[model samples]
Target: MRMLAVVALLNLVLVASEAITLEPCALALELTFWRMSGYLGYTLADWLCIVHHVSDFSIQPPLSKTAEKAYGIFGFSNKYWCSDGVQPSRNYCNISCEKFLDDDIQDDVLCARRVLTRNEGAQTWPQWAEKCRGKDLSSYLKDCKL
Candidate 1:
């Protein structure tokens, strides 16, 4: 029946969209790539730890309930870092927030780097100060063979 075929096609499309939207990163692999990309100001471990608390390394993190929604792996804010279309923004990263929600994180990393440079470092993220800072962050990279 055509209706059955249509339902099957819709299910297939849904599955495909879910796969595309939920591409999570593997930690060691991402770390290796990030290091090669020449990210500075924080150790890879520190970055991992910060990301752990911020978005649990989720590429498309859930939108926060607050007025200023944060996005992507680093939870870059719509208000200051990127544009989410819902809020007024400075968009200092000069990028659309939707771009951060995909598996390709090179742009996200670059934006986060800009945030670090302008905001004076990792302390720009309150989660870093509350959870990752001054902690023994060596464990974050322990399993990563990098």
Candidate 2:
């Protein structure tokens, strides 16, 4: 009986850990994006458009082409912004890339600010240039209570 109880407890712990680590992307709220925009010193509509095209607001967008290179909702590059264990990095953010993959975005916001300062503002992200530059962006914040 004791052994069975121990096994059950172990299973419960495993389930709890998985629940914490694998939080669903659906929990992301539009309000959170707006708040992030405020933190990054960007207009809500423009920031929304950029994030929409970059990671579709995913906290942990799947890594492709090369894992551990681009990460987080804003898709910060490991080569310049953050350090991935597998790559050579400038580590400008002084943060580990894995931190960007989690739901907490304060670090990602700080790093993104550095990226903008070092590069050409929003044009630092090619996706922004290709998808969001000089187009109708008010729609991104339309109907939001702001």
Candidate 3:
């Protein structure tokens, strides 16, 4: 009985350690894409599509870090309340997610910019800043020219 208990505890610890390190929202992005793909959806094992394909630069600060990164994935973090609420396809472009996973920073940045543009009339500086993690990414987004 004592040996069994030890083995059970060890297994629990191993499971915990092997858990996915990606943030809840990040994982959601990949999962959403895969699910939206329907029967054609592709996933490397149980992991989401983005996880397997995300480039090194995708995780960089501000862009993929902080609240700004959350905006990229969730679009208006506060509106979604971080991880809950309906996610609309029209507001948040599905194309951008694919481009982001591909490490196409330009398109990814453009996606973010498009959202900002659409929301410009409705969002205040504070809301915009909060969504972008208090950073102005205008220059970064428009530089792509496409």
Model number with the top TM-score: 1
- TM-score quality measure for candidate 3: 0.27
Which residue runs does candidate 3 get wrong by more than 4 Å?
Answer: 1-88, 91-96, 121-146
In the range 1-146, model 1's lDDT, one tens digit per residue, is 99999999999978645523322236546756766223655777677777788777666545478879888878888999999788899999999998987878788778887988898688899998989878898777666555
lDDT of each: 0.75, 0.70, 0.36
Q: How far out, in Å, is residue 23 in model 3?
A: 20
Candidate 1: clashing residue pairs, number: 0
The parts of candidate 1 lying over 4 Å away from their true place are 1-25, 36-39
lDDT of candidate 3 over 34-120, digit per residue (tens): 342222222222122222233212332223333333333223332322222233334344352323333233444344345445555
TM-score of each: 0.80, 0.71, 0.27
What local lDDT score does residue 57 receive in model 3, on the 0 to 100 scale? 20
Residue 3 accuracy (lDDT) in model 3: 100
Please give the range of 10 consecutive residues that has the lowest summed lDDT in model 3: 40-49
Q: Per-prediction count of colliding residue pairs?
A: 0, 0, 0
lDDT for model 1 comes to 0.75
